[model samples]
Target: MTATAAPPTSAPVGALSSRRLLSAIFALLGVVMAVWGSRMPAVQAAAHLGPGQLAVVLLAAAAGMVAGLQMGGRLAHRYGPARLLAGPTIIFGLSLALLGMCRTLTSLCLVAVVFGIGHGLLDVGANSAAVNLERACRRRIMSSLHCAYSLGALAGAGLAALTAWAPYHVLFATVGILTAMAAAAGLPLIQSAAHLDTPAQPDPTQHDDTPQLQPRTVWLLGFLAAACLLGEGAAADWSAVHLHTLHASEATAALAYAAYSAAMVAGRLFGDRLNARFGPTAVARAGAALAATGLGAGLLIGSATAALFGWMALGLGLSTAVPSLISAAGRGGPRAVNAVAATGYLGLLLGPAAIGALASLTTLPAALALPVLLAAVVALSAHRALDSK
Candidate 1:
């Protein structure tokens, strides 16, 4: 006798739910990051740490994130990204909440590691699932998903500011509870076990059941991801400084970062359509070119008002670069994606210091030109990096 199955319409329902669930996952990550960042000063004060000590703690967290990304990629490959998401999601929320209770450096370090692990795992799992979904649907949604993340971060940051008078523990607990609820709500939609039970579709570009990526190609892609992230890091860390260099008032300088962030949100929200119409390589190349042009213009103009426009343009230009590259990395499977993520993270570590070093050697505006050059490299090499050759 044949086994009875649900109606064919069920598949579409499941797919829709899965897509929503992926968006929720990404948003939750953004919320966690913003909440933690806003509450960082409190945590530091509780641990009685100075600026240098706080940097050490942050480095430890970064270390944990790197390790987790390494393991999360391999594990997600073996077990499936959907299945890998659940445990880490829960752990991440719990750790963030627990941060309020850590009164000493040792305890804070331990909790940070735990949170970092969760953060890294969720990052890999969610992005991996996004890639799979895009392949299944055969359209570009990565940019929209990232836009959701940016929106969530904005919302969380706003909430943190509004609730600044509340105790750290209470604020963190609120965020944690919300994250947990989101995870629970999305659990049924993930269908991770179902994915594991079923056979995976073959890659269109590959003949074998397994899609293999070359090591050299993987490294190349990793560097491309890193370059894109380098631009992102520079924008986040130095936008305000660049504005100040143009002799902007303190209040106007403060708006520089906000302008860049707003531009990023706008770019990502609309970028999916661009990706669908133009393709990833074209979109990425254009984005990089625009970023290079904007940053170069800002440096050349040496005016605060012009710099604001330049920063906004830079944000728009770099907005979709990482998403497009990450989606391409997903073609090689979870491990490949992880390699790319890890490499990209190295740029975040280096970005601030690199700018600082260059500033010491030259002028700040001159140092800021490095990201412009990097963007140009991305524009030129995007096709080579994205193709699985």
Candidate 2:
């Protein structure tokens, strides 16, 4: 029998450059999120608003994100990922800087809406480009790219603490300028490094879902992504509240989210190796189960330490789920990836609000059960939902 020839080795330049660009984009996005998130207390004080009013303003931003996601997808489909990437990067930085400059509640709300629009567009563009890059590389690198996001988030959050004494607008504007510069520099490197071919010379891996592009498959992927992100949104919004409700000190309660963010970073850093070995289906199923179990335990124990541990577990459990789902969605092209990303963003937009609504009817701890249930649903369906066969 003739010996099987080895598959030709892929070039490293485009793949390497794409990975760098994706990492920078993810990190910058994380920085923008942390810069704004870390200043929420300051914003509330500046605007002189209560929790309910703040929620309303935040909802405006979420709505903008949803609209942006829809439009960004269509735009990416029509214009290509490169333009979407370059344009949105600058807009995202500018909008984020504008957030700190808002003096009135109305101004804050409107700026938030615009920021959300930029954020949503940037997210879709980056993830869509990532999918294309992964196809070019023929490897599992999404987890590592997400790890960059986690690292940037951690840095931003930490920096917020150091700059807590600085003027809010000044702090935000400084970060925004840095982000804009990075975007200008990093995006061109990505273009130079990318191995894009014309439609006539499409990569085989890139064409896997082109023929099918089934609406049902896309919807199922979106549902799975939403389930994962809902848990993430809840953890981000309510972990501290849950700790405070359980009677932890103010300082201790604040550490709850830090634990989650840290665990997510660690999980993602190692997730690429895991995904490569076990495949996305296994990684997702196991992760969802862990998230459900961890969050449930935290709620059940009702202790500060347990809460921290739970958040950590929850972060680890959810970290790989999104990357796996997005990678799968990417095969279907930009529109498909955007649809999945949009659905996931909807979960982020609505999950916290749903928890708050339920908190009014029941209790905060009880409301958290919603995410746990969603995670369990993901665990049960992940294999089928992510199946490429």
Candidate 3:
């Protein structure tokens, strides 16, 4: 049932095959969802909803994501990564199309929940597959796999900006098309529906025992993951809004997120090299510092252009932390994947929801400062928390 029990086979050494293909496909799906979600402001405006109503709709998506992530790892463990990968992708594509059709607030909330489930499952399954493929390839391929996700996000943001003047339904339709293409692209990589069992490795200490993650380590990794996800979530949900507050046009405000996405993509592409040279602790520490500084500058300067640049710096700074943390969590063995994913997702789930709640209570500007301060705390603890291999 566990990954370590699988028999070793010579598939190909670091070759581009099923896993890489699937990662790319899911990465594109991730991009589409991110773009569609990022354009929520437009969606809300079109529906004539106030901030409170919009927050409710957003919470539905967040709740679904948390639920799906918690369950996805177990599903992957039971059925294998390929089935887990394909099923959710189809659902994601369908939900995206459905998202375009919803008219009422209730319909929108319903579709958002479905979309969140699909997105969450796809996230956990694809990343699980990527880790497996990397193990088979015997190389550091996780960062590159995540880089694909970042690229997809960048493309989605660009597509959204380009078609902002068009009907929102058209944008959703385009995203659905992209999602379908990604799903189709992944079909060749999936092996079968039946679970394949392999023998567990011999252990002198405990021949009959199964591997499991220590509870304490799982909690620690979860906390670290939450910090990283919260930082990224803050940027994703708020950077453009911050730019708009500084008097940027709608198109230009979107560009603030585009800048962040671009920098993030760039960072992920080179992340492995940096990780090799500096280690996860150093990278995380530096990233935290940069994210905090960028956020601070964005808030203090009060210029649209400067705020955009600051967001870009924040993106570049925060890029490697999540992927690195995921990799570290897996170090304890395959059993750690779910706990790690679930815990990390808890942060992802909370980050935006908390921010929205704060924005409701106080000003959006003041609420934005929360993640900046959190990032600073992460930076200060990076040396101790993230350094564990």
Candidate 4:
């Protein structure tokens, strides 16, 4: 095969350029997701929707995301990652503006579906691209790439907070238009650094979803991913509520998630080096163990302050697991990435609901044990599950 790209240290520089471009995409995606999330309260008020109604809208978007992930995997396999990204990236960008324009439940649901599809497509496409880029550079770049995404999300949330006074429509539309233009400008540079791995011609009759890794490995990796991400889903949905239940003030309750998120960003920022030095299997195992033990103790204690530290421990411990797993999945091929990511995303989608349902049956704190248990399982199983080589 021809050299698709270059290593970071031994580069003619094109691979480095591609890596930077991919980081930008990752960052932009983080910003988009964070901004949308920050404005959910505004959207809910504007559309006059209740909690259940809001759940329905969120579910609609999730359904669309699932569809996009399936399609994106096949497309990335067939088209090469750069080509796979072009359509979805643009769709992702423009769909944001539509989100601003909707005012009714029906309209909002429709827009949410579109937005979710774009988000899902971009998610797989970008990760697939980053994996290939990492391989080209012959280094552990996945964590650093993910760090850009975390930083982007922080930036987006800050932007939304600062612009809280603006109308939702204006805020969404303006950000959407600017990002869409950025997509237009960025696409050509991304496309120029071609990184095709498949043979130029393929047997049309061959099954298209075939992946490079053993089926067992893919599924197990998927399980690890699901387990790790479940903790994240729990933190996003329940940390504040859990704190609120402890009778913490509103401001303090908010800090529970903030601590988690900030610690996650901090962990990811250093993840590449840790992975490079200790290897992915070790990192995953250690991270999972830390999450399980730390968060487990936090739940057992009565103090909200301790809970915040527990979430921080959870965030830091789990921060590198997905990136490490995704990178491993990438070595298995795009179709492997597809299978593993879908399984993981499905877990993320289901995790919060599972916690909520369990909470109804038991106390919320007890239900929170689900993630801790999963993290413990991951800690036990990580080395066997991860394909580090």
Candidate 5:
């Protein structure tokens, strides 16, 4: 038989440049989601819905996100990240606008699902692109991309808090406009990245040198990711409420999220260096320890300032785990993506629900501590994984 040509080892020229730009656009979208999503309490108040009714609507959003996560990998593989990124972003913006217009619970639930789908798709596309881009650059870039998301989130939350005095509809409309612009900016990156196309068939002459991953490896990473994500999810869903509980005013309550986002951004910006110096295993373990400690301390101290500090610490600690795990899985090979995505997304999907359930059964403070303990478990397991490897 004739020998087959080997796949190219080098990234196409300009691919890295395009990837950086795409990262920025994805960050912008993340900011919009944070700002608008954090304002849900106000939106519910505007709709005159009780807590029970509002919970159902929010659950719809979570369900939609789960659905998107389940399908995102296949879609990205089939259609490529560019189309997957841009199209869903536009849909996300439209759904944001729809959220502003909805008056009844039914309408809100529908909008929530649409928005979740778009959000989920955007996340998968952006993250996949970020990972691929980093691989091409042969340096640490995922942390920076995640930092962009944190920065965007910080800006969005800041802006949302600042504009709380304005009409709620105006706030959402502005978010929609910003997200649309971000979608437009991302379109070019998708066109230029040719490697995102399906991988060529294997060459018979080439040896398969990729490392083999045991099934336990998948579950281990999944467990760690779930715990790390639980910490993140707690901050995203409850920081503002916690602040409010601490007697902060409506506008200032958002600062809780802002602090967490800022910490996340800062951690991510510096994460590449930290990862380089320490390695992914060390980073994940340390991050979990810091998060668990910070969160537990914050809840125990029971001060607004302490809470903010705790949230920031939690953000910093949790920042690197998800990206690091994703990279590890990808390094393991293609089939690993499904397991990584499914496991990671499962943690992400369950975080809010678990917190909400805990809140219902006991106090929010006690529920918040659940993630701290979970994070501790993640750190211990991650350290073992690293040592074994």
Candidate 6:
């Protein structure tokens, strides 16, 4: 029942397969996001949601996400993290399909909550599993697994674009059914790996003297997660619009996010190796500093090209930040990770409104400085947060 109990020759292979399975789960979640996001307009129209009503539906989902995170954490303690992954993920996929079927605001909102819950639970489950497996393997893999998410998002977006003319219901159904079916294969492997990789007995000589993270340090970790993730949300929501204001062509404006996404994926692909070499605190600190500096120069320069490069820099700089925090918090267990993830998600929810509010009061470029400032705070605080682990 433990990896060490297996033939010595098979341990590495088992670890590799487990990591890949977990990575697939991450990618599938990304696909769910891209499909749901890209099809939102259709959902709004299909459900006949009025102006600002869509926000209500989204808010419902957000609430469910927070709830799911809490539930996932508690369940992980009872059922084990690997066993906890598939149920929520399958539910998430199914709810997504159901989302396209609802024709009224009331019905859509209900399904949205379910969709969000599934999203949140699967996120925690997979991540907690990653935390456990990472320890057993004695390596840093959260970055590579997170990159799988980015790649899946890009692929999902591309497919959504190509299938733009299809009925949203058909699209959702296909994706949902496919995901539910695939889980039969991929998720079981992840659970089995967890079972195999976990040791039945501890080495008597090794004593884990590291204390559970202090509550204050937990809040600091949450703050860092929020600050950096807010920047990511800002880029997703505002990058194209920012480019448009600078007189970039529509096509060019679209490429602004493309550049950012590409850079983020690239950075994550290399992030684990970098972390192994430089340490999380150092790599994350340097990355946050780079984001702040890059965005500041971009806005100050006031050109389309400058803005695109700036966004790219910001994306790369913040790529490893949240993953590092999650891995750190996981040291305290799933509850700690739940708090960090839930708070970080709140930042994503608040980011657009916060940016828009600031933009209304000041110039967009000036408002954008908020993330720059927060990024700087992350750079300043990375050591404090990571030191807890």
Top candidate, metric lDDT:
6
**Per-model TM values vs. the true structure:** 0.91, 0.92, 0.83, 0.93, 0.84, 0.93
Please write out the lDDT profile of model 1 over residues 117-215, one tens digit for every residue.
888888888888887776555567789889888888877877887888989889888788778776776676666434321224453555532556677
Candidate 1 vs candidate 2: which has greater lDDT? 2
Please list all clashing residue pairs in model 6, or write none if there are none: 3-196
5 versus 6: better TM-score goes to: 6
Evaluated against the true structure, the overall lDDT of model 4 is 0.83
- Give the candidates in order of TM-score, highest first: 6, 4, 2, 1, 5, 3
Q: Where does candidate 6 have its weakest 10-residue lDDT segment?
A: 1-10
In terms of TM-score, how similar is model 1 to the real structure? 0.91
Model 2: per-residue lDDT, tens digit, 286-330?
A: 988999999899889988888889889889999999998888787
Error of 6 at 9 (Å): 12
Which stretches of candidate 4 lie above 4 Å from their native place? 1-9, 196-210
In lDDT terms, how accurate is model 1? 0.80
> Taking the tens digit of each residue's C-alpha lDDT, what string does model 6 give over 220-303?
999889998889889988999999999999999999877888899999999999999999999999999999999889999999
> Against the true structure, candidate 5 has what lDDT?
0.74
**In every candidate, how many clashes are there?**
0, 1, 0, 0, 0, 1
Model 4 lDDT tens row, 1-389: 12233334553247778878888888888888888889999999998999999999999989889888888887777777677566776787778888888888998889888888887778888888888777666678889888899888889888999999999778888888888888888877876876423322333554435445677888889998998888888998899999999999999998887788899999998999999899988998999999998999999996898898999999999999999889878856677787888899877889999999999999999999999999999888888767533
Error of 4 at 312 (Å): 0.3
- What lDDT score belongs to each candidate, Candidate 1 first? 0.80, 0.81, 0.72, 0.83, 0.74, 0.84
* Pairs of colliding residues, candidate 3: none
Residue pairs in clash, model 5: none
RMSD of candidate 5 to the true fold? 4.3
The order of the candidates by lDDT, greatest first, is: 6, 4, 2, 1, 5, 3
Task: Show the colliding residue pairs in model 1.
Answer: none
Candidate 2 residue spans exceeding 4 A from truth: 1-8, 50-52, 196-211
TM-score of 5: 0.84
